[model samples]
Target: MKFYKHAANGFKIVLERKITMHTTEETVVSFRRVSKIFNKKIMALQNFDLEVKDGEFISFLGPSGCGKSTALRMVAGLEKASEGEVQVFNEQPKEVISNTNDVAFVFQDANLLPWRNVLDNVVLPLELRGENKQESRDKAIDVLEKVGLKGHLKSYPRQLSGGMKMRVSIARALAAKPKMLLMDEPFGALDEMTRQTLQMDLLHIWEREKTTILFVTHNVYEAALLSSRIAVMTAGPGRLSALIDVDLPRPRELSIRTSNEFMKYVETASNHLENGSIGRELG
Candidate 1:
């Protein structure tokens, strides 16, 4: 394959001739010197700066306690930044949190209600929003089908496998049809085979829905496979260490993991991750 290079924000970017990932100049999320402190004692993030473009899939790859989840929570309006600013859709996250159509979050756990069936769990968000009953049910069914859970609509959380439960959780998020999905290790708990399957499923859903995604993953391979860019963070008092652009061709298959190009991307990300951790220790 042919290759070309370009520069943006002082960083070099390389792309393959067949690269198909699409992101616009329009900024969807921005963090300017943002920081997060818990109880005024512990600092989770410091001087974190990032810009997420429209339709981009970005992953946070860092060691544990690097505040990846904290950053995501701030984007979700579940946590407030102690310093600087965080903007989602060009507005303060707090300003848009009330608008259900703007953001959706999928956690590591399915967090499904045991008493509710699959369809009911998926429909719950719309219900809480006081949306029309029939429309909500229809949307739920549609998203459930998208996640390959149509036939299991009546199944309870207890009856499904770990992967299936996560699918239901994702379906619940997608049913809202949000403009962006904030996923915090949504597939980290599953087995390797199941994680690969769901990773493919997620890519398909992302391509079809055209939804921007902010994913957090500890797995370098997963980050390289799923992200348009991977943000490597330093250990505690987490900050941006490197923002590695993943220029892999889109519609990626599992087999791509073994490709030289993909391995190179993984190596780059892994190096950044290790350096970031070491830098924190030295500081």
Candidate 2:
């Protein structure tokens, strides 16, 4: 195992060796002195610096308008940074998007086509790239089953419940066999019970697939339950306030959330956000 360190704003950031069995090479996504401004007046991000390790499950936890989504969008190449650079796999974010099929995105909404069946929705990415219809269909079916949607392949998005639709979205993202998955509050709209169920399902999929995930969420418990590490952001002009390593044991079951150890990490993360320590630390 190899260790890497990043120096930003005079702070030394060190990443621990991953304990997973998966051998995928460690890829670091970093924001180097990155900042974003709208109309030259409003600052969305100010000198933001963060590093995400390959195959690691991490979350961006902050209040709305904290630039959590903006950071992800910058990585997705959907938005441009006004200053500094955003790198993925050590290449520019745009280069990563255009030159390789290494990333996939899941938004707050399912964004499934209402007219398409679950299988077709999952196959859409492959189809767009002109893969064989028969082969793509086979792959999509496999991924749908992986997401626990095997019985719903023929069902349309309109016919499925909110949770099911999100499953379809996740299946579609996985169909491409992406190295990194970016999720923006994918379960935020569901009921609490449904949200917890999906969270468990997501963790299962992450473990099985071994894909690096950058999940954005406002819920502290959800972040604690899902992320191996949580990066808390400040209120505005967002920057990394704190990067808390979650020492929770893996193959985590639902009961784990109620354990004292789990709540301790959650409370620590909450305190960082509540006391505005994140901003102060960055400053």
Candidate 3:
């Protein structure tokens, strides 16, 4: 899928989706008027319409109750949309999810088994899919190296640091080679330094694999740092309030956070975040 390319000297945002982009921009995930309510009164989301085109990195950014995580869960087929349709691969969420290697989710906690070593944990998805053990193990080994955990294949969850475990979690998610990856604040629990490292690592994986990523996070800076676009939501009946394009040049280094252009992007996202809208439609 193609993104609206931006010029460096401008602050304006324009998304020109052509008729041809419809063919080229394959939608990996979509939510149409989707709402989630708990206890039949607590409204987590209302009329949320979002479409993730193939290979796009979009982050859902909002306050705690604005349903960012809820949206992400819908994509993973873990939570049904209470009011509308949620699709993955142009089919119902569960339909696509029932098939192996279509979608993968990375949660906040690295839920790697304390007993399984890194190799086994990463290969678990394949094992469940009935893939040959030797082949899955070989694939998992290569993927782990890409995640910088090749050296820790024998280490258990308890034996590794927080970031290493998260890397393993990512490696596991990538094992099945899912077309779309849903992440719910996967690095939220880590320290700033560790989180930053994972952020860069994730970008590398995304670029190399061309996986469609729908990331849910509250950290504005993190969202700005990683996404092609950031969807800002409003509460009191959650809805998409803004879709802010990240126009920064990629192969992005951490030091780019200090640039004037980067600061401007942060300011724009922060403004939309604080006010909840910037005249952008949910479409």
Q: Tell me, by lDDT, which candidate is best.
A: 1
Q: List lDDT for all candidates, in order.
A: 0.86, 0.83, 0.82
**Residues forming the 10-long window of minimal summed lDDT in candidate 3:** 14-23
Query: For residues 31-127, could you state the per-residue lDDT of candidate 3 as single tens digits?
Result: 8888899889999999887777788888898888888888888888889888999988888888888875889999998899988999999999899
lDDT of 2 by residue, 1-283 (tens): 3333332322332233443534345656888889999899989898887777778898999988989999999999999999999989888888988877689999989999988899989999899888899999999999888878899888998899999999999889988889999999999999988898999999999998889899999899999899878888888888777777776888889899889888877777787677644435445
lDDT string, candidate 1, 1-283, tens digits: 3233332233443321112366667788889999999988999999998888888898998999999999999999999989999999888897888864789999999999999999999999999999999999999999999989999999999999999999999999999889999999999889999999999999999999989999998899999999888888888889887767777787889999989889888887776677644333234
Mark the regions of model 3 whose C-alpha exceeds 4 Å error after superposition: 1-10, 13-23, 278-283
**lDDT of residue 103 for candidate 3:** 92
TM-score of each: 0.91, 0.91, 0.91
Q: Residue 109 in model 1: shift from native, Å?
A: 0.6
CA lDDT for candidate 3: 0.82
Cα error of candidate 1 at position 269, Å = 0.5
